[model samples]
Target: MDTSIFTDKTIVPEDQDLIRELKETSVLWYAIRNHVHGLYPDAMDEWHYSGVKYGWSFRIKDKKRVIVYLLPREGFFKTAFVFGQKATDVVMESTIAPSIKELLKSAKVYAEGRGIRIDILDSSLVDDVKQLIEVKLKN
Candidate 1:
């Protein structure tokens, strides 16, 4: 998995607490996947975000799915930059936003604890993904 984006910077694995946060992110991500279809029945394929540590954007069934790209950027740890699919009118007012909100909340807490700042790419409109991202970041 050519992790060139992450290799440009150094990440100390010795941060046990950050390690724990990564583990937790994995677990919560799994749960989010399981709930994807139910949340957004029209989600689509997964797309990787550039210039992020672990940034990836994908669709569950049709709606967009966004996750934290835990990578170090210019000496700052960046997290939760929205890289998911665009949100459509159908998805903007749907339950997908709330569901994604919950997922991001967990991710934000985990990333923030590790001294990371979260941001959203906001390229997807099918899921109001940008708004979801901003909500989490602001909160």
Candidate 2:
């Protein structure tokens, strides 16, 4: 995660029009919402809840879905982190873990761009996640 993506102060939604398309393309979106409640108890009540950054926040829809941040924090927003849905506990363990990893990768880039590092006050569970992360850089 490069700390140079969050230099811009003007970040808009990735693609409002594409949102409908994404929802339509991703059929499991609804299921994710239905199952997310147990994952994030207070997410539905508030989406952009403050955590470490204070400058940025997270947005959760339904219970199973999370739209943490959009853009790479640089170059007018480069990427986004959107989680899909989970079925059973085993599936959740398999899927959600990767989603979180992706989200964190995006966040890391955002934070690095802002010249800040992520400090977890209580990160007792970060190690439990199991997900393969991928990042592509332009030449």
Candidate 3:
């Protein structure tokens, strides 16, 4: 089965479509978006279709710098972030989560930064994402 609900390249997902697929987690999705906008009023969000393998993803950017990518799944969503050396160090020293820290430790380093994608399954995980966002913006 496809991981994302919106896989059709010809079509774009609307707010109602997201609500139907995300269900309870839709609250988290909106919360995160609102949080980012609250932090960076000028943040711009756009949806992109990354072929069939990746499907559709919502990307948030603060001016030219990307803040995060929200990947919608069946009942939940994921948040992808790329942190530079400084931001990676901050995350390593943060109280985010051991698994996440481990993910960071093992994440392949790209020219951009160390990429880590986390599943925002519940409210507790949302806090971790928020912390990561703060680290990303600050560093």
Candidate number with greatest lDDT: 3
Displacement of the residue 42 alpha carbon in candidate 2, Å: 1.8
Best by TM-score, which number?
3
Q: Please provide TM-scores, in order, for all candidate models, with all chains considered together.
A: 0.29, 0.25, 0.95
- In order, the Cα lDDT scores of the candidates are 0.36, 0.30, 0.90
lDDT of 3 by residue, 89-117 (tens): 99999999899999999999999999988
Candidate 2, which ten residues in sequence have the lowest lDDT sum?
130-139
Tens-digit lDDT track for model 2 on 1-139? Answer: 4332223234422334224434432222233333344444454523232333432332444445432232223222222233222112232344434544444444433322311122222222222221211111100
Residue 11 displacement in candidate 3 (angstroms)? 1.3
Better of 1 and 3 by TM-score: 3
Off by over 4 Å in 2: 1-26, 45-58, 61-79, 82-108, 112-139
Please give the TM-score that candidate 1 achieves against the real structure: 0.29
Candidate 2: what lDDT? 0.30
